[model samples]
Target: MVTGGAGFIGANLVRALGEVPQVSEVVIVDDLSTGLLDNLDGLPARLFQGSVLDPDLLDDALAGAASVVHLGALGSVPRSIDQPLQSHHANATGTLMVLEAARRHGVRQVILSSSSSVYGANPVLPRQEGLRPVPVSPYAVSKLAAEAYAVAYSACYGLPVLPFRFFNVFGPRQAAHHAYAAVLPRFVTAALAGEPLRVHGDGRQTRDFTFVGSVTSVIVDAIVRRVTTTDVVNLAFGARISLLDLIAELEDILSRPLPVVHEPPRPGDVRDSQADCSRLRELFPSVRPVALRSGLEQTVSWMSGHVLTGH
Candidate 1:
């Protein structure tokens, strides 16, 4: 069973999973909170309309599934800042419901789509799986709490679950204007529209932007192999790109000039972050992630051809 299977990453995973010969049944449950209906267009899966917080609905979804991939959550840092209580309930409480349901159903494997924001304010380079968490925002706090639950449940109940701490993931189908949209999509939309490309704090803040394809591959491999890594694995490209450089690359990709809109750094914002994915290497030995430039080019092309043209 896949929760939030209609969002950017989730939708992509559904498409990928459909191509697997061994997979005959795929069940998708989503509330459509931030996910788009268009993402589910070609998917061949049993669809259920419900929130992860609904225990009755969750129980129904978890029943009879061999495993569960929990990707549903409130996904924006700024949105969390604006509405802390709502974000907490959706991400933290929602995750607990999924884990509990999976445990009760005797599911073999669970893969959580965690975040890199959990390394907040640590001033750390290439965040490792073993580092002490210092989440900066309510969103990050919620993810960290969910990770704890996944780990505790693993140790206490022996439920095999793997958590992937993703870093700056971006690709097609990402909502550009949603309250919690990732920064890359928003910037691409602004750039394509020839509007002011907003930059917070001099645009020097760096991030390890992992491609969505690579992220999905890692998750699928983890699930297929029933990966036994106890610690939350870092899913990233192991390279950092500054926001200024990112904008430049986007402008180059778009073949246009980008205007600038400077703003004060928002609260709960981290200075810099990258992922140390050696642990992911150990878990999935054959999975080599793609580079940022190539990934960005592919994403920008898709957005321009599809989203921008409205075709």
Candidate 2:
């Protein structure tokens, strides 16, 4: 079962999981709040259109399910700042409900998607799982609370759960039209339209952007092998690059220069983010890392055909 399966990363993961030979059926539970049902079009997966916070809804969805990938959460730091309680209810409380449901249903595996934003305000280079989380935003705090519940559940009960701390994950199906869109999708949209890529800060903030394909691949592998741990793992290779460098790379890929406009940094934004992937390597040594340029190419190709086609 995949929560938020109609969402950006969730949609990509649902498609990948559907393709696997070992997986027989895919069940998805999403409230269509942040997720778009169109993203799941033509995919061979069952959809339960409701939030994970509802016990009856979650119970009905998790019946006889082998695994649950909890990806349903309210995203965006600024949005969380504006609506802190809503974010906490959807993200933090929602995760607890999912965990409880998984435990009740006897689900063999549960993969929770936590965020790197939990490391906000921490000045540690190449963020490790051990770093003290000093969350700056309501979203970050909610994610921390979510992951903490997952960890606590695993410790209290012998529940097989892996709470992964995701870095800047991006690729196909990622929303670009929204006001709170990720930088890569936003940049791609602007560049394709011959508009200036509006950047926050001086455009030197670095991030370890992991492709959605790689993330799904690892997740599928984990589900197949029933890989579980009490600790959280960072899900990114050490491919950190600044926003300016990313723009330059995008220009190279498109074979045309793109314009840029600088804006003051927004509240609850991090300066730089990089992952310490040693733990990830230890867990999934067989998984190959996707290069940034190649990932960008895939994203551009998908966006060119899908997002750029029509209204």
- Measured by lDDT, the strongest candidate is 2
Tell me the spans in candidate 1 whose CA falls farther than 4 Å from its real position.
Answer: 309-311
Question: Could you estimate the TM-score for every candidate?
Answer: 0.97, 0.98
Q: What is the C-alpha lDDT of each candidate?
A: 0.86, 0.93
**How much is 42 displaced in model 2, in angstroms?**
1.4
Across 215-294, the per-residue lDDT of candidate 1 in tens digits comes to 88887777677786569888886889899999999878777779989899889888999888788888888997777888
After superposition, the stretches of candidate 2 with alpha carbons farther than 4 Å from their true spots are none
| Candidate 2: tens digits of C-alpha lDDT, residues 126-209 | 899999998999999999999999889888987889999989999988988887888899999999889999999999999999
Task: Tell me which residue pairs clash in candidate 1.
Answer: none
User: What lDDT does candidate 1 reach at residue 218?
Assistant: 81
